[model samples]
Target: MKAMVYRGPYKVRVEEKDMPAIEHPNDAIVKVQRAAICGSDLHLYHGMMPGTRVGMTFGHEFIGVVEQVGPSVQNLKPGDRVMVPFNVYCGSCYFCARGLYSNCHNVNPNATAVGGIYGYSHTCGGYDGGQAEFVRVPFADVGPSIIPDGIDDDDALLMTDALATGYFGAQLGDIVEGDTVAVFGAGPVGLFAAKSAWLMGAGRVIVIDHLEYRLEKARSFAHAETVNFAEHDDVVVHMKKTTDYLGADVAIDAVGAEADGNFLQHVTGAKLKLQGGSPVALNWAIDSVRKGGTISVMGAYGPIFSAVKFGDAVNKGLTLRMNQCPVKRQWPRLFEHIRNGYLKPSDIITHRIPLEHIAEGYHIFSAKLDNCIKPVIVPNAG
Candidate 1:
């Protein structure tokens, strides 16, 4: 098997590796068909994620066919095409019972957090990821979802992470009919956030980003109104104007590190004197949200701390929800949506390359060049 092995910061190699085999009674071995790079993967690539040591397989979003399954896996079998959930969770945990699969204690028992992510790091359970020709999926009966007929691998790949995250974000933000929702960032998660907002009945969906190409794609595919953050020095003003000066009912932070700390500062009315360039969209979303509005943050974060405006958040009485998506809970609903054609998440796919050229795709996507929005890697391409 060949895989994109992470060597160190800003380095990856397409090298031969041993094929994975089923290790547990609940395990299944998937032949990787299509996998995509995620923004979170980039965080690891740039060494922003702590404890991500070298030589780990690096991918979390993918769809594949089940080449083999354990005897205990009754729901799924050989030849079943499935989408892999990024998080590895056992379905019987306390948190999983409460529909909080992301916080399942059974997966990441030793860590401060509860979730375990593939290809993330040793801290996230050190599970080998789906970036190779074959991946061993634990908890196969509970985790993998068989793709319905007529769905291609490219379209089903997002069910693993981005699309589900976006759906979870929108659901957490309480997007409803006649509500106005503002999504920060136009990256893959942000794009899906906008689409989820629209699908959940948001009357107006505004997507903010620096890239014109992404914003344009958001407008066309997500049915979102666009705000080019680079064009407007006062993003808050633009957001306010768009939302009738009352602020949006719900603001989702899909740009995590890019917007997290700044949003905290803005909502609390603190001084914006931070030296580093945090994603301004966070501040804009906080300032652009109405009093008592909801904010859902699904972006990845680092250990570095930034000042937040606790006072303003208190005064405004806003509700802040933050976490990784509980993919196990959301996967069923998302899959149904995809199967029914109500969600076309694959519209975000901007590039498709063979697994051999995955490094090149990474280069283009990491640099944000050539209108590259989301790139998929086909492992079996010959």
Candidate 2:
């Protein structure tokens, strides 16, 4: 099997590797069909995530055909086509029973905050991801669902992570009818978040980014207003002014870790690794929302200190909600939306690369070249 192997920071290449076999009674081996390079993957690629070791494959969003399943895996068979959520967890845990699958206590031995995630790092349970021809899925019966007949494979792939996380972000906002919502970042998650806000009855949606191409995508695909943070002297002030000086009813920070607005913050957080992640976008969210409004955080950040405005949030009585998304929890409603033509997750895909050229795919996406919004990997391309 060929898998993308992480070399040091800013380096990755395809290399032949041993195929994964079922190691647990509840495990399954999946032959990956379509896998996506998520925005969060860049964190591991750039050495922003600690414990991302060399020789580990990095990918979480994938749909595949089951090659083999253990005897205990009753819901899935050898021939089933399924979309596996990014989370790896046991079904009967206390957190899983409460629909907090991302925080399942039985999976990760390293930490209690985040459950096992495919290919994230040792901090995330050291589970290898699906960025290759085959991957091992633990607790297969609980995490994977057969792709329905009408859902496109690409759409199903996105549902594994990006699409589901975006919708979950919007749900955390608790948007009331006629409320104005502001979303920071225009990546796949942010674009989907902006689009999902409209479905939740937001009267207006605005997407903020520094890239013109992504802002253009947000305007056309999400049908939301756009703001280039680079063009403004103070983006939070601009957000406040746009929302009639009281600030938006809700604000979402979809840019995590690598947010680039303040020079010092990016240097200390992203370059020097002094802080867990840059809090520029999150601070902007806190400042851009109204005093009593809600702020939803869907961005990926490391488990460390960040210079967020916690005091200000308390002063303003803001409701701060954040967590790693419980991907399977959003599937039922998302299936209906995709079938009714209300949402098309595949429309955000801008590049598709063969598994052989995954290094180049990561480069293009990391560099933001070719106006790339999303890149899909084809493990068995002809």
Best by lDDT: 2
**Across residues 195-267, which tens digit of lDDT does each residue of candidate 1 receive?**
9887788998989888899999998889889888778878888788877789999999888653434465433
Residue range with the least summed lDDT across 10 consecutive positions in model 1: 268-277
What is model 2's C-alpha RMSD?
A: 1.1
* TM-scores, each model vs. reference: 0.91, 0.98
Which residue pairs collide, candidate 1? 258-279, 264-309, 268-312
Q: After superposing candidate 2, which stretches have Cα over 4 Å from the reference?
A: 261-264, 304-306
lDDT of 2 by residue, 72-108 (tens): 9999998899999999989899999999999999999
